[model samples]
Target: MLLKRIQPMAYHARRLYVELMFQVMGRALQAVSEVDETVRREARALPAGLLFEMMVMPDGPRLVVEHTGDGHFLYHGSQAPRAVDLSIQFKHIAHAFLVLSFREKTAVAFANDRMLVDGEISQAVRMTRVLNRLESFILPKLVAQRAVKEYPKELRLPEKLLSAARIYLRIVTHLFQTARTS
Candidate 1:
């Protein structure tokens, strides 16, 4: 009786955590694409109408992202009704949080059996590359180096300053808007 009573509460808490994780991830992706031309270019390569998702297994919270146009995507909230072209599943709530929180690199997480990818290998690879690039801009340098294989080095001094300014400005704006409504 005690275990049964606690189980429902635990499940709800996990679901809520997953939902929040995906929301932050979606907003950060939008901000990064807005500020970085490279991300925009890569997003363009994704086939139109393609859907990608990452979530906890067996009906937990999920983030739905749809490719809308060249270098564009729409984050369609959690559990949108649609066919997923690619879905990445975490084995547990802890795994989902670790990977999404940027504490574990996607490559490392996949390699370590922390995630399962369903769909075409090629598409998954492409998505991973796009994600890596996005991380470089969104994460701090010290943290990003662990997240990406090879960080872009050719950014000139002026370009770095400009990109940083744009990225930060957009992130702050996004957070403010999110906070106001939440």
Candidate 2:
């Protein structure tokens, strides 16, 4: 009698977990679908020969979006994304690249620490370009959210370092141009 009672409780708990998961999934799906629509809209405006494949691994599912040929788009949502030239993994919803009110991709929790990138170097560069575009679009929102939080001064040093490097490059470029023209 005790074992039977325990079994029912365990089963109910599992069912509850599934239901909660679906609820979260519904929200995420909505977000991703919106992003898909935006991609489609943007595809219409892009110039030719800009072949793009976006593989996004969100927290719960992986989304592969490929824009093939003149404004054609294909997409799917699954735990196991189709093999492609590039894949981007997000560890959490916060890490996901939100596109047009939905996420383009999400990752499992541990993948962020693992930092796995499966693709050729050229593909990596392409991935960077794609991400750079997305970052420019959505990064301000993320920064604004974080701006309200109390971050240690030490944590921001890396950004300062990068800014300094950019300034140094600009100065060097000016010097080189002067040297060459003179």
Candidate 3:
């Protein structure tokens, strides 16, 4: 009986963790693409209105984002009406959290089969690059190094800090807009 109770509580906590990560990651993706020309080019190469999602299993939070035209994307709620072009579905809440956890590499997660891709392979690769770029901006050197195969050494410290600040500010503004609209 105690085990059953603890299991549910743990699940809820992990679920909440995954959901919050998705929210921030979603906004950061959009914000980075807006600010980085290379990322913007990558985003533009994708189909216009193409929606991407990272989700946990049944009833868990889903982060949905759409590639609006002109190299920009907007985060769409999980309930958004548009069709999802590609989705990276985590096996479970803990699995999602583990892969997204600080200092955890997504490539390792993929190799470990923690995530499943439900769309085109090319798009997934492109999305991976976008996520890697965003992570480089937001995560610390130690943590970001583990997340991607390479952390660009060319990126100056000041530039990275500035980009992170801008990305965070944009994320907060986006969250405010999201909350107000919701």
Candidate 4:
């Protein structure tokens, strides 16, 4: 009985953590698109007005991104808009938490059947590249090594530090601005 009770509490905690991670990631993507040339190029490759979503199955936390006409991305928060062009859905919250926490890389999670992609393979590949680049910029080198297939060789330590600082600052500022408006 005690084990059952504890399990539910632990699961809820993990869910909340994953939800927060999604929020940060959504904002980080938006921030990177605005400030990173590589990300802007990637966004340009995607179809304008593309709506991409990442969520856990069965009504879990989600992040939606829209590719704008000017080669940028807009974070749409957790509420998915109608007609998502591509969707990556984790089979469960545990799978999402594993990938979000860097305990499991995205390719590994997909290979392990922890995720389902519901969109064009080519578009998904492009989005995956964008996410990998974003992770490289935002994560520590050590953690990024585990999260990405290959750490970007050209990203010098100084540049990485500066980019991370800018992205994080933007995320915080955007959050504050959103809160004020709300």
Candidate 5:
């Protein structure tokens, strides 16, 4: 297997991923830091009154990002927007913030033991929404994808399960989102 060629099987799950997640978060932190005075000024130009405080916690079998924000971070962030905290254990990076925007399915899965989540629930959800519109979309476009490709492709999944899971997740998530508004 490609994964085997690169590293031993011991480097497969949790241990391997903890390292990877930190790396991903590192880039995210850098993205936050690197935003220039002008660029951030524009990004912060959402509304004079809308700013937020976001905290993400990936603490579980699958990644669990917990968010805590009042939806106002910069200008009138004094009273806090509306505190939202939620937790979810999502296995794929692709589905990260997208799920948080519209559905609680992932949160349910985590609570039912099929997934995992820790800490506050509302914040988890808030963090994810911010990421969906902010880090997830903007960072990739601003930076090259090559930097985060160190993980071997095969380790991305167990070959037999990858195709089915990815396709199924995409379809289900798409349909769910589509159904949400209508």
Candidate 6:
């Protein structure tokens, strides 16, 4: 029936969107760690060689992040490492889409049981702080305010724009480099 066809198409579309957003987020985290002092500090706080992943359950797209010893992060694409220190799994692609598209803040999603965290509580807290800081830097004020629990008062408009530009450039460059190698 038309409804059944449309439903499958919609699910695929949402899947693709979540995949792209995960890629952007992974790259943004890496980019911010290199350029932002706050992110660098947070990354340093995490254990060296720590590997974390965020994914949608049951064969959905995922991204892995690893913390280097010297206060930086590396994006490990969708292939999870042999042993991940933390795994944040969304219960469904719809849940991931909602959070990735900024329709639902991460904390709210977690509260609503959209995600499952398999890791230490303290490590999850640290990672959440890093994610919130990255969102503040890369997203516009209005969207960022809605996406994060509290937008930082210290992030002025000019600084936000500049940081966003820098992060976007890194993302694009990384994408191109990856495409070429692929």
Best by lDDT: 4
The Cα RMSD of model 3 versus the native structure comes to 1.7
lDDT of 4 by residue, 10-123 (tens): 899999999999999999989998888988887798889999999999789999999985668889998856889999999999999999999999999999999998999888
Ranking by TM-score: 4, 6, 3, 1, 2, 5
Per-candidate TM-score against the hidden true structure: 0.76, 0.32, 0.91, 0.97, 0.30, 0.95
Tens digit per residue, CA lDDT, model 2, 1-182: 89999977865664444334333332232232234333334444443333333323333434444444344333332322444555544333333323212333222222335234565545444434333323333334455233222222332445534433443454355446657988
Clashing residue pair totals per candidate (backbone < 3 A): 1, 7, 0, 0, 19, 0
Indicate whether candidate 2 or candidate 3 has the larger TM-score.
Answer: 3
lDDT of 1 by residue, 72-172 (tens): 66667776567899998888877776676667788888888988999988877877777777667656777777778777787554775677677668757
Candidate 6 colliding pairs: none
- State candidate 2's TM-score: 0.32
How well does model 6 score by local distance difference test? Answer: 0.90
Which residue window of length 10 is worst by lDDT in model 1?
Answer: 155-164
Flag clash pairs in model 3.
Answer: none
- What tens-digit string does per-residue lDDT give for candidate 6 at 1-182? 99989999999999999999998899998888877888887778789999989999977899999998677999999986678999899999999999999999999999999999999878887898899999999887899888998999999988888888988888888888889999
Query: What's model 3's overall lDDT?
Result: 0.84
Which candidate gets the maximum TM-score versus the true structure? 4
Question: Please, what are the lDDT tens digits per residue for candidate 5 over residues 1-182?
Answer: 78766554443443445444433442332233233232244334243332233222343222222111222232111123444223344554323332332233344434544444444545445443333333322333223122221222332224324433443454355446647967
Q: The CA-based lDDT of model 2 is what?
A: 0.39
Backbone clashes in model 4, listed as residue pairs: none
Per-candidate Cα lDDT values, in order, are 0.76, 0.39, 0.84, 0.91, 0.35, 0.90
Question: Residue 134: error of model 3 in Å?
Answer: 0.5
* Comparison by lDDT, 2 against 3, better one: 3
After superposition, candidate 2 runs with Cα above 4 Å error: 1-60, 70-73, 79-82, 90-113, 139-182
